[model samples]
Target chain A: NAGVTQTPKFRVLKTGQSMTLLCAQDMNHEYMYWYRQDPGMGLRLIHYSVGEGTTAKGEVPDGYNVSRLKKQNFLLGLESAAPSQTSVYFCASRLDRRVYNEQFFGPGTRLTVL
Target chain B: EDQVTQSPEALRLQEGESSSLNCSYTVSGLRGLFWYRQDPGKGPEFLFTLYSAGEEKEKERLKATLTKKESFLHITAPKPEDSATYLCAGRYNNNDMRFGAGTRLTVKP
Candidate 1:
């Protein structure tokens, strides 16, 4: 089912440049999340959507923005990229909170800000 | 604040050696704890989920056990194919999930 897929497996950006990462899922999940994984820091949530048209800040939401206009897609945008923003970003989706909590993760996008 | 911590950032084992990885969490209203295996440059693969204390799940040569405060992933007779970073996460407040830094395991033949 290609549970979840992310666009642009790898990218390099200059400081101040902006870009958006796209996440798509075909599982009809009701929850979507964006997280950054830094070495030794684990995965830190940047933003999440409980459902279409709803977005919320997470543990590390600064320097990132997100949108979930459709049920199957979630997007994470960087207004001004910085060296500190360079990391591996992952997208995940869950079927439902009450019914199941296991998250299905995408391959991940590796970003490098120069 | 919710936190999930794993011990022994890295480990090396010989073939047939058995070991256990640890995951401790501090989160209010814990809903579930999860285990995942991730190979380099790839996404995490779900392993097991523990919903409550005293729960245990097994897959192949790996076993996951959960308690009120922590979880353990025990691997038996490790092989090179089992080499990867193992991660654990705790879900709470329904939507909040916190992941550990992960424990990298290397099994050498």
Candidate 2:
């Protein structure tokens, strides 16, 4: 089974452009997260969903919106893409928020904002 | 503030050499520590999870140990394929995971 998958593996956009990155997981996890990794910066959480129909902001949720209408899908939307938003995005999911539960991750989507 | 710091930003070792990488973190309330291996441009792959001091987990050539303040990942007699960026993350019981910049390791044959 594909544990976790992210769409638009690679994309390039210009300032003021809008785009959405989709993340899907087949593990039936209750927690889903979006994170971005940049050089010299560790992965930082963007947004997260505890369960269907519930979304919460994380460390770096600015410049983005998230919707979790389905149990298996989490959407990350950028209303006005900027150079600072250019980074490799990763999707992660966990069965529970309990400590030590492994967080499965998707391959990742590399985005570049010009 | 929650934080995680990894040392030896980069490491190079011979095929048969062994070494350890350090991950020091200070969180609000320690819950768990995690280790992961990531290849270039790919998401991280889980390695081990340590929940308490003196707790250790091993897989093949890598071992992870955790203490209240820091964690260590020891690699023994690693192979070329073991080359990757090793990442460390930690969280409190609340599931607010924080990650370190990670250490890039290269095992030459």
The C-alpha lDDT values of all candidates are: 0.94, 0.93
By DockQ, the best candidate is 2
Q: Write the per-residue lDDT of candidate 1 for residues A22-42, one digit (tens) a residue.
A: 999999999999999999988
lDDT of each residue in B12-107, candidate 2, tens digit only: 999989999999999568788989899997899999988889999999999999877889999999999999999999876565689999999999
Candidate 2's C-alpha runs over 4 A off are: none
Candidate 1 to truth, TM: 0.97
Clashes of each: 0, 0
**CAPRI quality of model 1:** medium
Q: What's the residue-level lDDT of A106 in candidate 2?
A: 95
Question: Which ten-residue region of model 1 chain B has the weakest summed lDDT?
Answer: B25-34
Give model 1's clash tally.
0
Model 1 clash pairs?
none
- TM-score, every prediction: 0.97, 0.98
